[model samples]
Target: MASRQMQAAQIVEFNKPYQLSQVPVPQCGDHDLLVQVYAAGFCHSDLQVLRGQFGAALPLIPSHEPAGKIAQVGTQVKGSWKVGDRIGVLNFKNACGQCVGCRQRLRRTKRTDPRFCRKRQTAGFKHDGAFGQFMLADPNTTVHLPEKVSFEQGAPLMCAGATVWGALQKLKPDVKPGEAVAIIGIGGLGQLGIQFAKAMGYRTVAIDNRHEGRRLAVDVSEILKPDLVIDSSAPDASDQILDFTAGEGLAGAVVCTDSIEANAWSLQQLGNGGVMVPVGLPQDRWQFDSEAMVFRELTIRGVYVASMGEVEEMLKVVAHHDISSHITTVDFDQIPSIVERYADKSMKGRLVVQITQ
Candidate 1:
């Protein structure tokens, strides 16, 4: 048989562009699926990996947010999944089923644990990812897409959507619906956070910088319809939040920016007994007011991506609420230039690579 070949954008060196070239198609393993890529979402983390920020392996095919149809499945794959099933790949490629985390999750809930995996790694960074015509997928890290969600919409949900979804989920067992919640940063993750907050019945505040140009918060407010939009570029951003909340500060805040400056402001905006969740990966060191935290009894926590069960639930919410990532889809071949542009001046919305139709 002739060797199967596919087009892939690969990073051969650190801080270099992805080389779009023909490579041998990866074969499906015992628990793997050969996914025919439809779309792949690019993110800031991709930039981090490309610049060796996370010490990512070189010659990587970068893009974890991929949605597509299954072209082939391995024999050991056991489930309702089948060839031609529309699905999205999870960022956590595979977790060891024998770990303590995995056992605990399996016993207590349907969630899958990405940590404590014997061989845990992100798909796009460690393994060949979705910037290609085809990629091998671990059936364990893949989820079925709902009929209402398009491949493009499902792509970024694999990571960005799941990250924020999991963060918002942290807001309660204690926090009640209709409590004022703020989403900081107003970028891709924050945009989705706005929609999720509203759908979850929180009085959502969309926070970001005042624009010299088109304002993301304003543009998104028209779509997701956040209850309030505050430009934090101005010094009165926290004041605006307090005024809106009637002298009490935010019940919860999700800080989506990587800037320590943004994180500090978000922490200050939290009300008494409020929780502040930081999702951004900042490069610099950060400090918080120990006195304020002690006096106010504020909680600062962090959230990674969602568990598999949470991803399913988030997809349902998204589909039902008609929520979507504001994505700019480009041809797969343009991955190199776009990635460079992203590092210098990031795009407003999620940038996606369309591999197939």
Candidate 2:
């Protein structure tokens, strides 16, 4: 029989439009699962990869956020996973168990999780990703999609949701319930961050400079909406935050935007000894006020995507809270145009491409 083929949007060259081509369906490895993708989410990192910022190899299938049903299972894949199982695949693939990151006792430690294994081939980055009809997914990092969540919502949750959720998890040790927490930048990640913080029992504040972001923050349902929304561009934005917190300042803040100014301003909103977690990846180095750091003894923690266990936990919380992802769903053929439009950074929420019903 002829080799099975599937249509995929591939980056034929750097700084060029993706070519939608018919490619052979990838076979599952001993430890992999073949997923028939239903929805794929577009992220800022995809733009960076396309611009050659990460030096990704050419002819790549771009998109790290993928959710779908299992089509096939590997021979060695021993688990409940089987055909037609709803799932969300994390970007990180096979991790080397011998690496320091993998051997570490604490998975939450900075850059020490198995997901950080240097030898790992990340989906959408080092390996073929989810912009295709079918993709190979690592069973270890994959999570079961809750019945309440749709494919479109689950797709972005693989990256954007996991990212912000992990960032908030870092603050739990120091920050407590009823204490104020600010989600800076109210874009794709920030929108979820606010809801997650609220669900986690924190007094969530939504901060944004853009009209679309600010609007999104206020538009969420009453239960999941931010307790306070502030315009970061306003001169008294800091004062407004302090007033909401009764002048104590935020207990913690999650910086969700790539803008340097937003990152810097997020730190200023934190009270003495407050923690600041930056989830956004900015190309430029971030500069901070060393004097404030020394006197306030504030903590700045860097976080990446959540571990498999955390992603599963996040899904439970998402389902229990009835959290929803604001998304714009488009057909798979529109991937090129969607990518081009995403360059303007005007998208309000997550953008997902529906590959199948």
Candidate 3:
């Protein structure tokens, strides 16, 4: 049973360090689980939220990429889950199951009462997050973790893995299973994007601006076995990409960096009839030529958080393909310091914050 209060990393204000404090461990009375967090992924999204980029809740305990065992479940909760059940928490806390969008999609097989529909609350942002030793998860936003998946790998799957995989699943850019798909900015999301794209039977061309990242891409390629690696740091990267694409250009590209400049280039590199899905967030507005978009039918679009169904499909792909996460684990207390460093693009792969694992 959860005690009244517990350890949590809550931010007091903008630009201030996250403060570690003992706060009440909330109950799962609202058909939610009191998850004893085992491993929570430290995501770039966490950094974005911490810096107020997401602009949802403040003075908050911030962490969305969470996986853990069920510590407790509400009495009225209706599911096969019990205490000790392992599950993953997604970035979206709740979407109204009664709204036309929700009812048509997630609510089809789920609890359909609009009153139970959570139009409000986002864990780790509007609501509290899994940065704590214990966090709350509603039935709608939780994903069951497969037995074969480890806490470290499962941890990153909650966000980095799911975010990219979910994007690919939703966008479904028309590159055939064996055709090439270019990825920009080989970082946490980019790395996962490469893996998912490769696993989906798409040849991957990982593009990065730094020698360090290019070298890392080589290492990742050996592990993940992506088809092509291009050093975008070189001036001839676009030309090299053209050569690699047989002078045609990529079938599609998923812009995975938090930069408008990089995305603008991806827009250009994507020749006739190509789609570029922008999964990364940038502070500046994206600019592109309307003529280019119309003439070539170039697609530049954005993707947000994953749906519950999409999260399950992502997990299935992870299991069927056995895509592992190269993760670094840290104790719960290290989250603030680690998150700060992560904001500067210092941490690697996905950071799994140890809650119990």
lDDT of each structure? 0.84, 0.89, 0.75
Which prediction has the highest TM-score against the true structure? 2
Candidate 3 per-residue lDDT over residues 1-357, each given as its tens digit: 666887888877766777889988876785778898877777777777777876865668888778889998888677787888889987665555556655755546654422234585767766688888888777767889999887778878777776777667654746678777887877777777887888788878989886655555555535566677887767898998888878888878888787878878888888788888888777778877788799898877666656677778888887877777667788877866885566554555667788774
RMSD of 3: 3.0
lDDT of 2 at 188: 83
TM-score of each: 0.94, 0.96, 0.90
> Candidate 2 or 3, higher lDDT?
2
RMSD of each: 2.0, 2.1, 3.0
> For candidate 2, lDDT tens digit of each residue in 1-357?
788999999988987888899999998888889999999999988888888887787789999999999999999997899999999999997878667666672454533344767678888976789999999998878899999999999999999999999999999789999999999988788888988999999999998888888898876778988988889989999999989989988899999988898898889888998999998877799988888788888999988778898999999999999887789898888888977667566667889999887
Where does candidate 1 have its weakest 10-residue lDDT segment? 212-221
* 279 Cα displacement, candidate 1 (Å): 0.5
Top lDDT hit: 2
TM-score of 1: 0.94
Residue 221, model 3, lDDT: 36
Deviation from native of the Cα of residue 191 in model 1, angstroms:
0.7
lDDT of 1 by residue, 72-143 (tens): 999999888899999999877677777787777777766557644656767887778899889888787789
